[model samples]
Target: MVTDIIAQAFVDFIRRVCECENLWKAHAKDLELAKVGDEVTKAISEGVEGEYGPVTVKVRKKLLGRREVRVWLYGNEIDVDALLAEISKARSRAAWLLNDCSENALLETLYKYEDRYLIEVAQRNLDKVKNICAGELPRIEFGEAPAHVVEGVVKGVRIYLSGHGTSA
Candidate 1:
């Protein structure tokens, strides 16, 4: 049962990162269009196909072909960098939990297969996993998986909208 939870949690982390990647890709495309003074609002909305749940976008057309785009996830304003950082941290914690639980022979033997929602199952079982381990878990350094563009112009429309360099 515990191993099942661990696997589910690992999968959830992976899926969440995938969703973030989708969002980043949308940002890139929209920003590129905005840079060229093209209509970006429609492009932005069309990019998000509701796969990651409710994502809201607010775009303002500024003078001289500048645009300001802001995004929200589940009604909370989000900074792409900050959102990625938080999700990465959560995934790391989940990874540690999964690792520690998988090391237990008894727990490994008791794991059962299920087709239920994996993330919900993992979240529900996480506390139980910690109790089962009942000891300090060694820090597991994933060493930064190749992530979304971490900085510079690719982040969002900020650079493109600010008229910082040669226009596209």
Candidate 2:
């Protein structure tokens, strides 16, 4: 059935979005790592001019406060607050996308696709994937980054940062 085809694509896309969302949520505080990664990488990534720009910087585990955290202050420039805000919005959007664009969403779209032509719906959803793949999503710097980037960083930080905070 056409719905099945569309459903498969939808599930794949939404699952990716879910993984991306979880990654952002895990690094909701570490903007530096969220923007880049734990290692050094440089590329000509710019959706527009006057943005983060091209530069090279290395990131690694550094002791901060009573624990180790990843922070970048040399080689490249980024707004920590801004990055955190983006992470917040990204997290919310990911959850929304997964829920809103789930199998049911695709099924519903399939009806419209059928009414109009299957290609139409497929293109729209595919556009989302393309944008995501190209890192053109709303508030993310890079979407192609592996899903484990943030997850790994968080686990690494939690190894040292978890108990340092006193909340009760």
Q: What TM-score do all the candidates reach, one by one?
A: 0.27, 0.25
| lDDT (Cα, 0-100) at 88 in candidate 2 | 55
Q: lDDT values of the candidates?
A: 0.38, 0.38
True-vs-predicted CA distance for residue 28, candidate 1, Å: 30
Over the stretch 91-112, how does candidate 1's per-residue lDDT look in tens digits?
A: 4544443454333422333234
Per-residue lDDT of 1-168 in model 2, one digit per residue for the tens? 433444444434434544555555554534433344312222212111122322232233346723222223344355544444544564565556556655455445445423333334333444344344333332222234333432332232233223334111
Q: What lDDT score goes with residue 111 in model 2? A: 57
Clashing pairs in 1: 1-110, 1-111
Query: What C-alpha lDDT does candidate 1 achieve relative to the native structure?
Result: 0.38
